[model samples]
Target: MNNSNTAFELTIVVPVFNEEDNLERVKQEFDSYLSKSPYRSKVLFVNDGSSDNSQMFIESICKSSNKYSYLQLSNNMGLSAALKAGIDYANTEFVGYIDSDLQTTPFDFDLLMEYRHDYALVTGVRQNRKDSFVKNMSSKIANGFRRYMTKDTAEDTGCPLKIMKTDYAKKIPFFTGMHRFIPALIMLQDGKIKQVPVQHFPRIAGEAKYHLFNRMIGPFKDCFAYRWMKKRYINYEIINQG
Candidate 1:
């Protein structure tokens, strides 16, 4: 219920887990990016109940910078919950998202924001994914199946960069793997979503957080959910004046 007033022009949500090593680098990257971005943007860090020193690092970053801010859940929530929480609390016209592992460059947001006006959501597709063969192949298989089921056809829904209208992003239902269905969900609501190619880098410090189960099995089940919702999803418009 907080942030009821519209103030920030953009809120960039950074979802973090046990990424203590990458935390400071993430803040500096965003701070440097905000210096040049046309629209003033504030960074929101969501700590997903990390048992590490992630919360302390987030607080230090917030205290050092006025544009930086953060929130920590009582316990670890999944990525979907963390993202939805940020969107719910965001009081900006545009809410952007990126991961804390530093896989994607924060400054690449300029590419997405350029088309922000015409799109309800702007997402990134990694043309040259900087992942291992196993990671890359598994993602491809998952993406293909997801497209067949949900028919969203987003080349890289797994890419960790996006900018969306706060209102539309807030309306998306919070399923466990709903993060993968953002473009599809926006399409279902008759909203426009643009996908742009962005830079991808290898993880520098922390270990790969995703395992085979979460990447392959988790998304498989959620795809079925997306299809089910797609069939029964509600959409209506008022026709005429009284």
Candidate 2:
């Protein structure tokens, strides 16, 4: 890790799994963001035990850029685990998440940062999504169900382009589908969230990790899990500590 990179205020964690084809584009997009971002920023590529050449590409990217680094998971623990690992690893004041696929632009992070001061979480809502009809409808159903269950009011929880304060992010409990409930989790901590419209593009390479079953049934199950956690969640404030 570059010592100077530690001075950054924001760390963007890009979780990767079998996204070897997308690494280069990811690097370029983030590198461009770092050059133009209002806040001092760096990118942390989390390798979620990708069985492809993703690690090789990640290592190469990290080696070539001081603004880039990575964490390698032992195996494919799924998106929630990978996101949690990245959040745990982040030491900056704020952390952001973006998918390895170039569907969302890293540049949109700047828009999220604009509301960073007022909201504990700032996430993107993709405008004019370029996915297939099945993908779009499934996502809409999933989002609607999640909103009804968690009452997070997040239109696009699965947008994948989000920024949140590191402290708030660290407070979230790790679970298989925690990634889908980030805004709700922040709300659990009595934190505020803001959503901004962001540009979305079609995937240029690599296969999507999710399917109809996982997108619909998986989130349906996780919604109940979230409700259970919400009921049992505990929050308190300490006036003083010795």
Best by lDDT: 2
Q: Which pairs of residues collide in candidate 2?
A: none
TM-scores of the models, in the order given: 0.94, 0.97
Model 1 clash count equals 0
Per-residue alpha-carbon lDDT of candidate 1 for residues 1-242, written as tens digits (9 for 90 to 100): 23533446888899889999999898788778888877778889999999999999999998886788888999988899999989988888999999999899988888888998899999998877789988998999999998888878688889999999887888787778899999999888789888898989999988888976689999999998888888888876669988
Quick one: best TM-score, which candidate?
A: 2
lDDT of 2 by residue, 127-174 (tens): 999999999999999999999999999999999899999989999987
Model 2, which residues run further than 4 Å from truth? 2-6
Q: List the residue pairs that clash in candidate 1.
A: none
Instruction: Please state every model's RMSD to the true fold in angstroms.
Output: 2.0, 1.2
The positional error of residue 185 in candidate 2, measured at the CA in angstroms, is 0.7
